[model samples]
Target: MRLALAQLSIESAAVDDNVERAVSAIETAAEEGADCVALPEIFNVGYFAFESYERAAEPLGGETHRRIREAAIEHDVSVLAGTIVEDLAASADAGEAVPAESGLANTAVLFDADGKRRLVYRKHHLFGYDSAEAELLVPGDQLPTADLGGHTVGVTTCYDLRFPELYRRLVDDGATMVLVPSAWPYPRVEHWKLLPRARAVEDLLYVGAVNGSATFEDASLVGRSTVYDPWGTPLASSDDDATVVYADCDPDRVDEVREEFPALRDRR
Candidate 1:
C-alpha cells in the first residue's frame, strides 16, 4: 500500500490552523493515490505546549478528532491522526486514585477509509528529561495494533521510539509495520534517524516515522520524515521542510525477510 507521511508545522495552541493544514495534507495525499495518510505528533496543539494542555485537551471523540474523521471521510483515505491530549476518565466504581482535574494522555487516533474510528494508542513511554510530558501526562498501559489495508499495523508516538522492547512486542503480536508519529527536535537528529531504522532492522518490519516542522523555544523540530523497509533500507525520506513523504510498502516483504533470515527465532 502507498503511505503518505505529512510533515507539517504546528502553530502552538492554534488548533484551527493546525487542523486546516493537516486536512489539506491529507487531501493532497489522497489525490496522489495514497491509501493511508499519517500526520506528525501533536499536530492539533503543538507538542511541549504545557500550558495549553488544560485548554486544548479534548475527549476521545471531541472536536479535534472529529475534524480528522471528516477529513478522512472527505478524502476517502485512512488516517493516523497523529497525537492529541486526551482527558482521562475516572474509574468511578473502582474507587481507584483517579486524578483530579482530569488526567492527560498523549493519544493517537486512527480513522478508517469510511470514517470509522479503528484504533487508539496512548503513548506508553513518556519523556521525562526536563520536559512537560513526564510531569503532565499519564502513560498508557495497552499496546494497540490494527489492520490497515492488508497490513498489520502498530501505532506509537514520540519518545516511544527510544524503546525497542515496545516495537519487539508489537512485532511479536503480528505487526508487519509500525507507524510512529513524532515531534522530534533538533540536535538529536542522529537519534531520530538511527533509532527507527534500527527498530525496523531488529523487528524485521516496516517503520514509518512522521515528524513535525515547528520550532520551539529550546529547539526546532528536524522535519526528516522517513520510511524504512523490512530490510532496513530507506524507501523514502524528506528534508527539513513541511512536505509529504511517500512510500509504497508491501506487507508480504516482512514475512519474506523473516522466513529467509530466521533472525527472530534466535531471540531468547
Candidate 2:
C-alpha cells in the first residue's frame, strides 16, 4: 500500500476555501498513485479558530462529508477525512442515537474508494495544555478500525498522539497502520516528531501523521507530516509546508519487523 499525507495550510474560518484545498490535495495524491490519502485535524475552520467551532460544526453526513465522498470516488483512493468538528446536537436532532452527551467532538471520517463511509472516530484524548479542546469537545468512548489498501487502519486525531494506550488498543483490534490526523502547532516539533516514531517502534505498526501547515492566530501549525515504519524508520517526511508526503507501505511489514526484533514478547 501507498499513503499520502496531506499537510494542508489551514487558515482560520475559511471553510469553503479549505475544503477546496483538501480536494485538490486529494487529487494530487491520487495522481501520485497513493492508495490512501489523509487530511489534518480541524482543517476547515483551523485549530486556532476556536470561536468558529460551534458555528462550523457539521453532522456526520454533512456537506463537508459529501464533498469528501465525491472526492474519494473521483480519485479512486481511500480517504481519511479527519478531525471535523462534529455537532452532536445535530446528530441527535437528526434522530440518531449518539452514545455521548449533547455537545461536540473532534471527529475523523474514513471513506473507501467506492465512497462508503467506513469509520467514524471521535478523538479520545483532547488537549488541555494551553488549549480549549478538553473543554469544548466530548471524549469518544470507542476506537474504530477499517480495512483499506491491504491494511487494517485505525484512526486518531491530533491530541490522541500523546496517548500510547490508544495506539496499543488499535493494534490489538487488528490495526496494522494507524492514521493520525493532527493540527499540531509550532514550538513542540520535537514532541511531534518523536511520539509517533516511538509509538511505531514500540507497537510494531505503521504510524502516519498528517498535520496542518498554515499559521493561525496565537498559534502556527508547523507541518512535519511524517510516516514511520514499525522499526521507527522515516519512510517519508516533509518540512513546514502545505504539500503531500508519500510513502510506500507494506501491511505485513509490522510482522516482519516484530518477528526479527522479538521485543514484543518481552512485554509484561
Candidate 3:
C-alpha cells in the first residue's frame, strides 16, 4: 500500500482554515496515487492552544470530519483524518461510552475510499507532562482497529508513542500496521524518532507516524512524519517542514519478518 503522511501547519485556533488546509493535502496525496493519507493530531486546532480545546470541541459527525469524508469520497482514497477535540457529553448522548466525569476526548476517525466511517479511535493516553491535557481530557477506554490498505490498521495519538503496552495490545489484536497521528513538540526529537521505530521492530509490524509541521508560541511541533517497515527500516521521512511523505508498504512484510525472526513468540 502507498501511504501518504500529511504534515500540516496548524493556525492556532483556526478550525475552518485548518480543515481546508487538510483537504488540500488529501487532494495532493490522492493525486500522487497514495492508497491512504493520514493527518496530524489536532490538525484543526493547535495542540498547544489548550484554551481553545473546549470551545472547539465538536460531536463525532461534525463539520471537520464531514469535510474530510467528502474529500475521501471525491478523491477515492482512504483517510485517517487526524484527530478532533471531541465533546464527551455529546458522545455519551450519542450512546457511545461516556467518561466517568464530563470532559473531552482526543478522537481520531478513519474514512474508507467510499467515504464511510471505519473506526473511531479515542486517544488512549493523554499527555500530562507540563501540559493540561490530562486534567482537561478523559483517556480512552476502547481500542479500535480498522481493515484497510490490505492490512489491519490501528490508530494511536501523540503521547501514546511512549507506551509500548498499548502497541502490544494492538499487535495481539492482529494489527499488521499502526498509524500514529501526533502533535509532537521540539526538544524531544530523539525520543520521538526512537519510540515509533522501536515499536515496529519489537512488534514486527509497520509503524506510520504523522506529526504536525510547525512550532507554536512557547511550544513547537517538530514535523518529521515517517514510515517504518516491519524490519524497522526507514522507508520515508520528512524534515521539520510542512510537506507530504509517502511510503510503499507491503502488508505481507510483517508476516515475513515475524516468521523469519519469531521474536514475539519468545515474549515472557
Count of residue pairs whose backbone atoms collide, per candidate: 0, 0, 0
Best by lDDT: 3
Q: For residues 224-255, could you state the per-residue lDDT of candidate 3 as single tens digits? A: 99999999999999998899999998998889
Using Cα atoms with residue i matched to residue i, what is each candidate's TM-score against the true structure? 0.95, 0.97, 0.97
What order do candidates take by lDDT, descending? 3, 2, 1
Ten contiguous residues minimizing lDDT sum, candidate 1: 90-99
lDDT of 1 by residue, 6-74 (tens): 998788889999999999999999999999999998899899688898788877778888888998999
lDDT of 2: 0.89
Better of 2 and 3 by lDDT: 3
Task: Extract clashing residue pairs from model 2.
Answer: none
Query: Once superposed on the true structure, which residue ranges of model 3 sit more than 4 Å away at CA?
Result: none
Residue-level lDDT tens digits of model 2 in 1-268: 9999999988899999999999999999999999899999988889888889999999887989889889999999999996799998898888755657489988889999999988988888889898998889898888989988888999988778788888888877988899999988889999899898998888898999999988876888879999999888999999998999999999888778878997777877
Between candidates 1 and 3, the one scoring higher on TM-score is 3
